[model samples]
Target chain A: MLCFINGEIKNINEGSIGLKDLALQRGYGVFDYARTFNRKLFHFEDHLERFRRSAKELRLDLNYTNAQITENAETLLKGSDLKNPALRLILTGGYIYSPSGNFNPNFIMIAEELPTYPEENYTHGVKLLTYEYQRELPHVKSINYLNDIRLDPLRREKNVFDILYYFQNGITECPRNNFFVFINDVLITPKDFLLHGVTRKVVLEMANKYWKVEERKLELAELNSADEAFITSTTKSIMPVTVIDDKKIGNGTVGMKTQKLIKLFNDYVLQFSR
Target chain B: MLCFINGEIKNINEGSIGLKDLALQRGYGVFDYARTFNRKLFHFEDHLERFRRSAKELRLDLNYTNAQITENAETLLKGSDLKNPALRLILTGGYIYSPSGNFNPNFIMIAEELPTYPEENYTHGVKLLTYEYQRELPHVKSINYLNDIRLDPLRREKNVFDILYYFQNGITECPRNNFFVFINDVLITPKDFLLHGVTRKVVLEMANKYWKVEERKLELAELNSADEAFITSTTKSIMPVTVIDDKKIGNGTVGMKTQKLIKLFNDYVLQFSR
Candidate 1:
């Protein structure tokens, strides 16, 4: 696979970062991932906007403009032969010490095959484990998934898809996805302490036309009364969450409303791809 | 300078990790740093123990044993001519997808010139700004310093040495050091929700002989009544903190007790190096 590293396109194996790069030294970097459909980048502008925001929040000197990054990503996607390429853009704090104050940021873009989950995860709904934790700097899409990746073994042992993080009795989000629940015929999601996912934004816009949408602080206790629940991400789109911590959500099956939203999101993606 | 990567020793510039390595990809890595005194590693066993704990906390498979890592560090230090070298040991989660579960961990040891702070910082004592934040997995020394690095501009603008993190009115720690304060002539530091630094452990042991040491939750409001304050780390050792958020600590000078502790720690280091 071809990857873009500091203005050069090369093989992914040859795309190595120096040990001094803060991305490795201090994990001081921000990244955003988006997927392509039929060789077309899906919601590239929104992803780019978030990427720029994340970089600015970290004070990373993202020298390249959005247009330049988009062009480079296009070049990378065109150079790759993957059916559905997933583009990961990383902006790192540069390799200089603080006193000198000269930071030359390293920008990296990797084109890889879009990872696919089990089809049953979307068809019959997936299960998630509940974890009582909150991410630091929740708004920025920084490359800090230490807590999330550390639970891989427990997640594998429990046979769950992902972990749902809740803090102080309030539900927040998953590691890589934004969570939504339907309660008493109202579509709702947590309003704060999570990355504002692009797919979640699209789902809100689409669902507002068909159902009542409420974005507010969602309580963990409210999940028991939820009529339906699902998660949204660029990779998964809309995956129904039928179980949380072995507890059944809406009869432990994919709810009708979740299926409808999935269809709507799929239609929107198809239109955007065209 | 030479660095130890996996099992081979190579030049520092040639030590590069693949883009897929989770240290860069997901910030899934842990590291511990130790410095040498008189060309001898100071308190190396304690640092290695903490490093192992951190790696286990992150579930990073550190393939090398402590003895093996120590031998490698000695080799790197012997190969380099730099006096008082700083050794940074990083254990990454490796470059492989999780499903197949074949994680070939990458252990990297980089030897560099020991970073030096301004001499006046120690003499006149340093100032720190207080920020209402808490680190995730505070016990694990993971490669997640995004928040700390992001505050570089603010710290430079305010001309403070570092940021003191407090959570819900309780003092936690500094970004890379352990915080301690002397309140009413009693030495105290936060007990929980922070990395247990090796220097902190040694300081507590030594302080017990001189002053009444209390390891409990230190409140942020207690700083106002603090007679003295200081931070401990591998690099800074026992540097005094005379001001926090522009508030004067005691008479805004390095306290007599801090100076005494500093002398004691230096003497201990001298003995260890011999």
Candidate 2:
């Protein structure tokens, strides 16, 4: 594996950070994940935009600009044997905290083999467990995932793919995916209360051209009446949610809308991969 | 400075973690801060207990046993020239994430100079700004401080010492301190909606011996009628809040109860330091 640490390329085994990095000390950092298809990045600009936004939100200084990050990533990928790679860009609060002092941000980019999902997961869909919680900062993509990581045991025991978070009355996003449902032919998902996912934006934009897309509060009650449900993420693209908390969603099979969206997403990716 | 990374002691400048350390990658880690008084750690057991509890809450494996951690801290302190140092014990999720795979947790202990607060901060007390925000997984002492760091500008502009967090109905806690209010001669602090700080536990236990202590819900309205309010933490100990949101807290000076509690705390620390 190849990685970029502070503008220098190194083997994954050699990629290390100082103990005083604020990301390790106080979880003060922002990161964005992007994936490559056939050696080309999909929605690279979108990911960079979100990365910059998340960094700004956390008040973390990005020592390198977006162009520099992209250029470095491209250089790393070009020197690697990866065809379909997963890349993570991290900007940390830096090594050591001086009382009311300037910080030197740590910039790291890691490229790894794309995670391979079983074909059954996309075909038969996946189960989800409901968790009652909200992220600290919904808009910013910080490195904090204690809530998500802590639920791994329960998630594995229940044989679920991810945990869908809900705050009291409304359903928020999943651990790493954005929730969407087709309620009475109008595609609906929670807005403002969740991280705006890159793939979710793509699906929403493409879906908006064909279907009525509403970005608003999605009540938990509405899930029971949904015609179909699915989740969008950088890795999964659009994954159908067949079972949610023991309740079968839309006859427990992948819905037509979900299939259609997946097809559209695949087409979009393929068209841009070249 | 000397520090413990994993099981090895290294110079602070040479202490480093892999880029894949979950603490850096996902901010999935728990930490506890303890301060030394005259080179003797105060409430060392309490801090360790909390550290273990937090690691348990996060399911982070401490490859080293509690005894090992204690021994390492003692060795690090003995070898260092730090007097009245601030020590932090961190247990990260691991170096990588795998599906249904065990992770090798990264254990780190860092010792640094103790922060010095102005005498006026403890004598006249400090001002506070109120923000409506609640921490996620408040019981666990994770490195997630996004909300607190995000409020840095507001805190600096107002020249306030800290930001007190409140939910819809009542005050929860300050950014890094536990909130306490003396209402009608009874000392009250939020029971379960915040992290139970070591110093807070000490103060509560000591205060219970002298005054009425109620560990229950404290309504936002009670702040206005309260005789006094203060915040507690390992570093700050019992710091009184003179002004909260521009409103004077008990005549805009350190209340007698706060001063009394501070004196009790100082005496207790002095007794244990030797």
Candidate 3:
């Protein structure tokens, strides 16, 4: 595995950050994850745009331009032999004792084999545990995952795929994925307090052509009336949700509409990659 | 400066963590800080007890026992030439790709010169800008400071000492300190949704003997009826707060009770260190 750190290419194992780095010191950092399809980065620009927004929101200065970052990522990918490569771009508030001090930002790009979910996660669908959590500064994809990582044991113990966070009875999102549900022939996803994932954006664009899409607050009680529910992310693209907190969603099976959306998303990705 | 990383002593500059460290990857880590007075750690046991609790709450395994960590910190301090030494102990979930896998925890101790606050921060008191925000998992001292660090520029621009976080009209705490107010001659501090700072505990114990101490929800509106206000932390002990959001607290000057509490806290530290 190879990674680019501070403009230098190095083996992934050799990539290290000092203790003084604010990413390590105060968990002050932002990151974006994207995957490549057929060795071509998918929706790289969209991911970069969001990454830039996250950095700007956190007040982190990115020394490299979008083109430079893309070039560095492409160089690392070309240098690797990964079949399904995933790129993780991390920009950290660099070494400084005081927050107001002038400090350089540490930019890192890691290339790793993209993870493949079990086929049953899509065929038989997966379950999710509902948690009442509202991420701080939810719009920015910061490095803070304390709530997600700490609740992982409970997630594994319950045999759920991931935790779905709801705040004030409104379904927000999963730990790393944006959630969408179909109710009364309408597709809906929460509009506030969540990372707008690239795959989610694609699905919205595709689904809008076939079905009515509403980007608004989806309540927890609304899940009971939902005909189908699914989540989207870079890795888990349009994965179905059969059960949530032991209650079966849409008769404990993947809905026909969700399956169609998955196909549509796949076709859209194929066209984009070409 | 000297530091300890997983039982090995190294220069502070050489203390580097891999990119895969959960502290960097997901910002999954717990930390506790304590300072030494006259070359000896003050209330070391109390800080260690809190640190252990924080690690347990976060489900992070501490590879070393209390005595071992204390001894390691002492060793690092002894090797350092800092006059007023402060120790930072960090326990991070070590390198692992998946959250379910077993990970080796990284225990780190860094010795640095203790920061000295301006004398006016206590004598004439300091101002705080109130912000409507809440910390995630406020009980455990996790490394996630995204909210605090991001708001640093705002704090600087406002020329305030720190941001006072209030959620649901109740004053929670400062970014790094526990908040207290002497309202109508009775001392009050919010008991929920904030870190149980060690200095706060010491102050509560000492103030109980001299004043009426109530650990309950301190409403933001109650600040108007307050006679005096102060904040407590390991680094900033009994620092008075005379103004909050441009509103003068108790005539916008350090009150007599706050001055007495500061002297009492100083005497307590001196006795503890001896």
Candidate 4:
């Protein structure tokens, strides 16, 4: 993979960073990722906006202007050999703790070959297990991921690819993906228990365009009996969830609504930047 | 400051990282910092034990042995010019995410000169405010620090150093310290809602040995009516809480028990270490 650190392109094999990025020190970071389609970056503006919001929430001052980050991302994408690349953007600590707001923010953009999701993984579906932990700061997209990292081992042990997190009240999200369930033809999702994912947002927009959607506090009971279920993320796109906690969902396969929403989502992203 | 990464000693001024260290890429990390007294690390073993626990909780495997980490820490400490230094230990994501029960880990550790804490601020007492966010994986000490990062910006805008956090129940902890309150000669603290800090642990041991101690959920009511209050941490050691949420704690100065605990805490660290 090719990576960009502070405006310079470097091979992932080479080490990068300076002493100042506390994201390396204290895990202070804010990042976002998206993919490109048809020679155009999908939801670049939306992702960057979220990235900026995350930085604002974390108080990590980025000296690089928004225009600069966007330009750099585009430049790095062009510099890479990837035609249909998955793009990642990362910003780390630059001294917000120094009593002065000055920070030399670490901006890294990496481009890699797009992943080919096994069609069945989304069609026949993947099984998921629920975790006991919840995101501490779900409203802002911050970089501290210990909650998810802590569960990754268990997921691996269980041979599950992802996790469904249940807080005291309801289901929140997957480690990196936002969760959704089809409840009686009305799509329902747990509100405020997740990062308000960009892809989830796209799904919501599509829902508004084609289906009834409800964003509220979702109870575990609702999820246990949902007609269908799926997860959304920039990378995963939309993948149907077949089993949660060993329970079959939606005839043990991807549902019709999910497939329809996937088409709507693709249309949304393809037209978003172009 | 001296740091070791990829098995080499490097100055903090030249601190850099590899792309694989997801502490930068994805904020996957676990770390702990313990101090040195007279060239010997205080609670070094405890710190390592907790570090391992933190990693285990986060499911990040540390490929290195405790003995190896200790040796690296010692080497880094010896290279640093500052004799009375505060140590910094960090572990980040390796190139691969291993999920099996056994995954060879990639992590790093560094020891740095203890930065000077403004002693006068503690003497005069510092002002702290409550934050909405709390640590999700309070046990593992992961690299994802978005909550702390977000609270920091507001703290900066308010010009405060520490951000006290309170969950829905009551007060939890400051961003980097644990809390204590003395009410009606009964020393007490918030339970489960705060990090079980080393200094806090030492204080509790000393208090149980010499005074009335209570460990349970603490409501804001108890703090408001407290006779005295204080906080503990490796950095702060022990500092009395003269004021909390604009209310005077005890005589609005260091409490008598706080004074006693402070004296005992130093001896505890020294005696416990050797």
Candidate 5:
């Protein structure tokens, strides 16, 4: 895979960053990723907007403008052979701070093989584990996933696909995905203190047209009692959540609403590509 | 400076990591750094123990054992030209997860110049800015300084050396330093939901000999009214904190207790190095 790092395109294997890059040294960076369908970026502009916002929030100075990044991504995508790819925009706080105590932000646009989940996961849905931890600075997409990574063993042990985070405040979000649930025909997703994912935004818009879309605080008990549940992400799209912890949602099978939303999301993607 | 990546020692400038490294991609990594005084590591074993515990808590499979890392540090220090330097041990979650979903941890031991703070920062003391952000995993020392780095502008604008973190629960700690306060000759520091800093541990042991050391919840009001306050870290040692936010700490001059502790810490360091 070809990656654009510091205005130069290099092979994925050759894509190396200075060990002193703030992203690695302090995890001081922001990133946003968007997947490609039929070799075209899905909601490219929306993702870039969020990417720029994340950098701004973290006070990261991007070497390249959003327009330049988009143009570079287009060029890189044209030469890429992967039918579906995930393009990630990374902006680091830079190498060693200069004498002036300023950072030279390092920007990189890399393409990776789009992760392919099992067909059974989409058909039969996936189980989720519950964790009582809230991400720090949930609004910004910073490179801090220690809590999520530490929970990997528990995730594997529980045979779950992802973990849902809910603190005393309320249900926040998943490690990498935006969570939502359907209760009595009302589609609810957490309103604040969470990343406003592009997919979640699109899902909200789509669901609003057909269902009662509400953005508010959702508790674990409300989630367990949800008629149907699902998570949205660039890669996961709208995948159903059949079980959370030991509690089964509805009848332990994918509900009609979840299936309908998944189909609707797929159709929306097709329309987006066109 | 010569550094060690895995087993190979390379020039610090030439040392680099793949973009796919989990440390950069997902911030899945653990790191511990200790400063060398007069070409000798101060509290080497303590830092390593904390480093190992951090890696274990995060489930990071370090490529090298603690003994191997110590040996590499010694070798790297031998080849180094600097007198006083900081050695940082970084263990990343490694390359992309395999098909079976496993990470090959990447280990790197790098040396950098020790940060030289103004002499007045110790004698006249340093001012601190207070932030209301709590770290995600306070126990594990992950490469997540997003909250700290984000406060750089505020730190500079306020002309403070570092930012102190306080939540609804009370004063937690500083971004990089462990906070302490002296109330009526009793030394108190936050006991839980904070990193067990190596310097803090050593300071606690040393302070226990001369003063009453109590590890408990430290309220902001108590800190504001403290007789004297200080912060402990690998690099900062026992630097005095004269001002927090807009409140002046005990007449805003280095207190006798703080000075004595600093002297005690320096004397201990000299003895350790000998």
Candidate 6:
């Protein structure tokens, strides 16, 4: 895997900070990410749109317009080697101030090969223990992944794939992926309680054409008895969750409904590669 | 300002990232910052302490240790020809994993100079409003700050310096700084509910010697009637807030208690440069 940090390919050994920098000192920074297929990015516009929105919310001086970012990204990809890679942009809160007033903004970019993913798990099906917590920000992806990381050690030790973070009230999501439930004939997904995933948007598009999709604040009553359940993300695509907490999701198998939606989404995304 | 990206003093204009880059796409990145006073860094060890904690929490791999980071940052600073710059170090969660599961940790570092303080903000003191939201990772400083940016437009339009976040029962710190209250001879500050600021720590050190210092959870009631109120961070050492939510802070002229602490802190830090 190769990484271009501030426009350079370098050894990971020499590219890091001392313990005391301010971003670490106070958690002051903003970032965004998107991946590519066959070395070509899909929905680059959408990713950047969210990125710009994130920067604005965090007060990061990205100093690049969407068009300019698109141009640069396209040019950079023209010379890359990997068949598939993931990219991320980072902007730090200006260097350490007296921890005082107006401070200079610090910026950097790291372009690297796509990080690892559990490809097999998506296909074979995964179990989700109902996690006990509320999604802090159901609307945005911020860098504070502590909640996610907190469970990593426990999950690894237990050999589980992921956890379904549902509100005690039965609302689900606010985890690594957005969630949906297919009950009877309706494709019901948690809305307003999860990040409006880019992939979720595409899934909605697929559902609009072939299924009765409904976006509503979901409740536990609806999910527990649902005929099917699934999760969506840039990498996960549309994978079925065989179980949530301990209850079997639609006979503990990838429901036919989920597979169809995945097929539709994959086909739509591949159109970009062509 | 001088910036050392992978130990090079390159102009920021020369820096750019490929769109398909992993850092940009995954948001797998980390960074740290410190300040220079009379051409030297202050509390450098403390910054590194937090930096390491953040990296550990995020599972980011640094190419080097504390000594090496310091050396690289210094070399970059000297090479870039900047003095009294707010020094920086940024590291991205490198493209360590191939999209197909192959692994290569690609990470990089950049050290640069930025303003330590904005004269206008420090001298005149700007208006401040409470942000409805707070930092995502109340602990580790990951490179995610969109919430701050999203609230900025509303803040700037409303003529506020920074938003002070108050949860259901208590007052959190400013979106950018730790909040403090000075009453008669007792120094009351928000504890556990805000970022444990290095500047706030310094304030505590001084208060221990000059006044009564209480480090515990502070109620909103304590802030409203305080004799003096100020904010602290790595940059804004100690800034008096004359007004909050349309109310005055003490006499609102940088109370003697607040002023004394700021002076004491500066006098303690200036020793590093000499």
lDDT by residue (A61-99, candidate 2, tens digit) is: 676777888888988887777767889989998975553
Order the numbered candidates by DockQ, best leading: 3, 2, 1, 5, 4, 6
lDDT of each: 0.90, 0.86, 0.90, 0.75, 0.85, 0.65
lDDT tens readout by residue for model 5, A231-269: 989998888888888788889898999898888888987
Candidate 4 lDDT, A102-215, residue by residue in tens: 556777778767666787887688889887777666776766665566665677778777888888867888878888899788898888767878888878977986678999
- Candidate 6 accuracy as lDDT: 0.65
How accurate locally is residue A241 in candidate 2, as Cα lDDT from 0 to 100? 89
lDDT tens per residue, model 3, B1-274: 9989988999999989998888887888889899988889988899889888999988778878888988889999999989899999898988864668676779889998998899879889999999999999999999998888878899899999999999999989988999999988899999999999989998999999988899999888998898899999988888999999999998999999998998888887788777
Best by DockQ: 3
Could you give candidate 2's per-residue lDDT for residues B1-274 as a string of tens digits?
Answer: 8899877999988988888788888898899888888877788889988888888887777777768877889888877777667788888888766757776788889988777789889888889888888888899899998777777778778888988888888788987899898878899999877898888899988999989899988888888988888899888888888898899987888899988998999899889876
- Candidate 5 chain A has its poorest 10 consecutive residues by lDDT at A95-104
Over A172-209, each residue of candidate 6 has an lDDT whose tens digit, in order, gives 67467888889888898877656777888888887987
Residue ranges of candidate 5 with Cα displaced over 4 Å: A98-101, B65-67, B98-100
User: Candidate 6: which docking quality band?
Assistant: incorrect
Q: Between the candidate structures 5 and 6, which one is better when assessed by lDDT?
A: 5
Write down the C-alpha DockQ for each prediction: 0.68, 0.71, 0.78, 0.56, 0.62, 0.11
lDDT of 1 at A145: 89
Query: What are the runs in model 1 whose C-alpha is more than 4 Å off?
Result: A97-102, B99-102
User: Which tens-of-lDDT digit does each residue in B110-180 have in candidate 4?
Assistant: 66666556876567666666665557666555655556655555776776657777777577888778888
Candidate 5 C-alpha error for residue A236, in Å: 1.1
lDDT of candidate 6 at residue A40, scale 0 to 100: 78
What CAPRI class is candidate 5?
A: medium
TM-score for each candidate, following the candidate numbering: 0.96, 0.96, 0.97, 0.88, 0.95, 0.74
lDDT of 3 by residue, A129-180 (tens): 9999899888899989889888878988999999999999999999899999
Q: What's model 2's lDDT at B15?
A: 86
For candidate 3, the C-alpha RMSD (Å) to the true structure equals 1.4
Per-residue lDDT, model 2, residue B131, is: 84
lDDT by residue for model 1 over B118-176, one digit each (tens)?
88888899999999998988999999988887788888899999999999999999999
